[model samples]
Target chain A: MIRRRKIAEALFKLLSLSALALAIGTLVLLFGALMVDGLGRLDWQFLTSFPSRRASQAGILPAMVGSTLVMLVTACVGIPIGVAAGIYLEEYARRTWLTELIEVTVTNLAGVPSIIFGLLALGLFVYTLGLGPSILTAGLTLALLILPVVIVTTREAIRAIPVHIREAAFALGATKWQTVSDHVLPYSAAGILTGVILALSRAIGETAPIVTIGALTFIAFLPPAPVTSQPPYVSFEWLMSPFTVVPIQMFAWVSRPGEDFAANAAAAGLLLVGMTLVMNGLAIYVRYRMRKRVSW
Target chain B: MEIRETVSISHSSVMESASHRRARRRREFLIEGALLLAALVSVAATITILFVLVFESVGFFETVPLLDFLTDTLWTPLFDDPHYGILPLLAGTIVTSVVGLVVAIPVGTVSAVYLSEFASARLREIIKPVLEMLGAVPTVVYGYFALLVVTPALQWIWPELPGFNMLGPGVVIGIMILPLVISLSEDAMRAVPMMLREGSYAMGATRLQTAWRVVVPAATSGIVAAYVLGISRAVGETMVVAIAAGQNPNLTWNPMEPAATITAYIVQVALGDLPHGSIGYQSIFAAGLVLAVMTFAFNIVGHLMRKRFREVY
Candidate 1:
């Protein structure tokens, strides 16, 4: 019996360890391969030049600029609304069937395939709204896509506020608004910011929705600047300008029938992976600091 | 004199606070209403998705009989003689997902068991962040990796394997969902009480026996939920299959061959220039409807399982 038990223990240990190793090993292999294939293509010129008919000369400049612009638009659209919704659900909504339905909807939305979001954006924004495959449409699609993530995280952060803190403010004759705006939000700002940043990072690396909305794959010029000679110097025209993003450009390159383009795709993939990792790192660091500072 | 002074003070305060309270109440009501609207955006989005999918698919069904779309063996809408049969795409999705689950389930469950039961606190801390970082790597990147790295490696070992095979993307997606399955199942396992494990041990059960017998059975619902969610992810995955799995809509039992998934089909169509309102354009919405229903059914099953069978420790 003892020998059998020992054998069983040893076998299970090996099995579990191999599983762990597989997970970590895949990550290591992914990054290692990406580095090996992509490093040669990364350079100053790669960042500055435009897409070319030749893969050797093609750069990710327009895609990079477009991605940044789209993220900016996404942040603006997603953050305030998501945070507010989260605050409402946590603090104001009473325990009822309606609240339960909303909660379920949010959870379901989070699990919906991202491609469906692209399809929805294709239908609503590009076609019906006549946004014409612009940056604004792409940004809106991503904003909707990440809304549930932001709201859930924000609700969690708000929920983490100690009850005594809220009671203390209420005991001082503060109204709900004053208490939340002053005490609750200030305390959870770091956590909320971390969640928002992570969600935006996800948006940054997204490919499907943008592609579904017919974003240009080979644009040489940037979107019209936000500020220009238009009557409203802060031009809304840029929002209407057609755009492409990093992942789309990378996908286009990966599909091309040549080794050079594949290498170029790798280079772009490296940049994208680097950006996502950095943002995720920052979010993790913020979370760690928040946990340390706020033990509750 | 004291009675008069008290009366005056009470009267003045009441008069001053009435308008103040009204304004505050109105502001509070307005704020709450606005926030409620914000909260309902998700509900609105869900409604919009359903409406759009159904409304657009109406055109497709009008063009192609619903029975034919469902029963036909081939999906060749892009060809000259278009057949709107969904079987090939459906078969592709099922095969790849089965492949993914076969790879993910055992590995993820075992890892979760280890993480929850055996790992030291410090090890868990280090591993958790690494897993989170892994999950953060985008699906598009995974697609690229699957195409460039995994397929080449597979092709070397199995010379018969096609250039764009289901197995490559299947394995990559399995890895992609590992963190999700691990975290969810770990939470479920950790939720199982320590007393149960202790009881099994008291009965002379070994640690492995306790985990596999006592703890796993106790956390079955959560593990099931995790599996269902993972399957949902595999069913709806887009870029990985689009990039790695060949866009050939073939009804085959083999994972070694290339097959086009519903998602990949949608992507292939979207990449091309189909005029709006054409039957080809509307077919995507039809596909989307089917995909949406599939995911919804899976999610509902998972939710119900978790709700009904979850043990309250």
Candidate 2:
């Protein structure tokens, strides 16, 4: 009986270790395969030129530019609103049924599938509001998609500020807004910034919601220049211009038949994966450094 | 003389005038109002999503009978002679999700157990980020990997496996959701208090026995919540199935067959040039509503489970 029990324990340990190994091994395999297939395709030409009928001539220029512009809009619109909401929830709102309802709604929104967001954008933005599948619509769709993440992270960061700190500010004749802005916001900025970066990273790789809003898969030209030598140096024309993002571009290539297009898809995937990993790495590093510095 | 001059510095000048005080109060009030509006955006978003889905689906259900939508097996909204049965898509979703869960649950659970109960803290810190990276990888990339890599791999084991079978995407999804399951389950297991394990050890139980019998049972509700969330994720996953599983709406449970999930169908219709307000376009909203309802139900159950079992120690 003792021997049997010992053997069972050893077997269970082996099972557990192998389970972890399997997960790590898969990640290694994925990166290795992408490198082997796509490394040679990464070049200045590939970065600068427009996608072509011939797979060798194709580039990610238009797609990359569109992604950047869309991200700009998403950041501008999403971050301030998300941060304010977070501030309201953590710093100001009293515990009440209405706050509880909002909390539940936010949680539920976070779980709603990305594709559903796409459907919402289609009905609301594209048709009802007549945004017409522009970068603005895609940005708004993704802004809503990332709002819950931002809010949750912001709230957590604010909550981490010690109550004594807030009390001290209050005793110093600081109003609620003054305490939050001067104490809470500054203290939590690192955490909130990390969350923002992570959220943007997630949004960057999103394809379904963007695709559902009917992002064009093929675009040979970039949007109207955001900065130009013309009378008004900055332009809003790009917001309404048709756009294609990297993931959608990759998807288009992957669906087509041929080894050449497959290679291109692999190359695009490498770039997308690399970007998200870097952002995640940065977020982790920021959190680690902040935790080391702050005891309370 | 200098001390008297300093002492006599005007107190009234230092204090804010009534107008200034009122202005500051007004500013505070405006800021609060703005912040409240920002918080309400989430509520508005929820309401708008519901309205959009239901409104379009209402238009769709008007033409297609509700009974046929539920009971019929076919789903060909784009065909010349259209059928709006959602079962085929639903079947596809169930099959793939089941296959994914089969692979994920055991492996993820084991990994969680190891991380929470067995591994050293330093080892856990390293492993945790790597697992998070797996979740962070783009789904589009996973879709590509599923189509180009995993499917070819399965063909070696099963010679008759088609180019676009559900098995490849299902397995990849299992890998995709593995991190989620591991992290959430590990959190649950770790929350099982240390005294319970001590009690088991005092009773002459081995570490494995202690974890299996004591901690696992204690954290059962949380683990179940993790599983439910994983199921919701698998069901809603779009790109992997879209790229690997063929877009045919086949009503079968076989993992070896090609089929379209509800999400994949929505993508297909969106990619096409279906006119706005047409039956084909309207059909996607109907499909989306069903998808939303299913995931929403799972999420609520998971939420309740977590809430009910929290802080049990």
Candidate 3:
């Protein structure tokens, strides 16, 4: 019985190790497929040049620029709103019916389909508000998409901060705002900021909502300034400028006919993937360092 | 001389100090109100989304009756006053989701079991992070990978199917949501006390036997909840079905044939060529609402089940 038991345990170990190997194998195969299809076509021109009528000459420059502007704007809109909501819920809200309802609604909001948010943007921002199919409209839509994520993370961060800090501030006769600014926000800022970065990275790769908001399939020029003004100031023309993004462009390329288009699509996809990875890596690193600094 | 006017000075200074406190109180009230209002923003956002969907869907129903939209057989919104049948789209979405759930549930739950139950401490550390890495890859990448890789391979064996079809996306979506299913299930499985596994093994049960008969049943609710939530994700998934499944809305059980899910329809119209104020735009929102409702329903179920079934031990 003992000898048989030994053989069975050995078999289980071998099988389990193979299963782990299979998972890694799947990851490698995916990365290999992406590189094989994309790497040879990628070049400096591919990175910096503008889109062209001809398939071979077209580049991701406009798409890349548009993505940056939209992402920055999304972070601008989402982080403040999401983090503030988080702080309010964590620090101020009472354990009442209202707060419990608010919690449930937020969780449900997180589950709402991304496409619906696009529809909301199309109706309210594009049509009703007259934002048009421009960079601002898409950015706002993407911001809403990442709001729940930012809120969730921010709440967790706020919860992690020691209560003693808040007590110390209050004990010193600090007003509520002073306490929050001096102690709460500063203590939790790293974790909350990391969440914002991660959420924006998710937004950057999003295609559905932006496409719905009329992100151009092909843009001849990089995004014009989103807002315009007199001589030296920002102009309104910038706000109205049509834009393209890496994910939207990649979607277009993938659907087209030419075999070459597939390779280009993969190359573009790789760029988007690389950007997302870097953002996520930075977020993780910051989160790690921040947690290390905190003791209890 | 200094003592004579003490009353006047004290009175004025006290009045000024009281006013200053009042102003500070008002400012605090305003900021706190703003914070509460921000939390209320979630409620506003959801209502706005729902209201817009209903508004546009009404616009759609003006062209096509509510009954036809719900009950009709075929979806041909491109043609003249095209039959507004939503069944085919609904069917396609469900079929794909069912396929995804079917594939993801067992494998995800089992692998999760292996990790939480029998794997060494070091192995658990490695496995959890790898699952997270899988979770982070974007959906579009998975969709294209499915189209360029999985579909072609699937076609070689299943010659009866069309060139581009639903199976690839359905299967790939299963792979895509595997991490979610596994992660959630692992959490649930791990919450099962060690005594249960130990007791079963003491009765001379093998590891596999203990996992399947004893531990798994104990954690069934969590496993089931993961399946429910995973199916929701697959159903709401847009890009995979949009690209891999040929943009043809048909009521068919066969996974190999071209069939358009609700999300694929939304993406198709959203891509372009729809007249600005036409039914096309309305249909997109209408479909969006349907997708939203389906996923929301799943989320509620998953959350409730998770809460109710959590094992304290």
Which candidate comes out best when scored by lDDT?
2
Chain B only: TM-score of model 2? 0.95
Interface RMSD to the true structure, each candidate = 0.9, 0.7, 2.2
Please report how far candidate 3 places residue B231 from its true position, in Å: 1.1
Q: What is the TM-score of chain A in candidate 3?
A: 0.92
Ranking by lDDT: 2, 1, 3
- lDDT per residue for candidate 2 within B1-313, as digits (tens), equals 9877766665554564667777888989999989989999999999999999999999999999999999988998877888889999999999989989998999999999888988999999889999999999999999998999889999999999999999999999999999989988888998888898998999999888888889999999999999999999999999999999999999999999999999999999999988999999899999999999999999999888887668576
Off by over 4 Å in 3: A1-23, A226-230, B1-17, B159-161, B198-207, B311-313
Error of 2 at B124 (Å): 0.6
The 0-to-1 C-alpha lDDT of every candidate, in the order given, reads 0.91, 0.93, 0.82
Give me candidate 1's TM-score against the actual structure: 0.98
Pairwise lDDT winner, candidates 1 and 2: 2
Better of 1 and 3 by TM-score: 1
lDDT (10s digit) by residue, model 3, range A102-213: 7888888887767778889989999999999888898889888898999999999888888888998899977887788788898889999899988988898888788777
Off by over 4 Å in 1: A229-232, B1-7, B309-311
What residue pairs clash in candidate 1, if any at all?
Answer: none
iRMS, candidate 2, in Å: value is 0.7
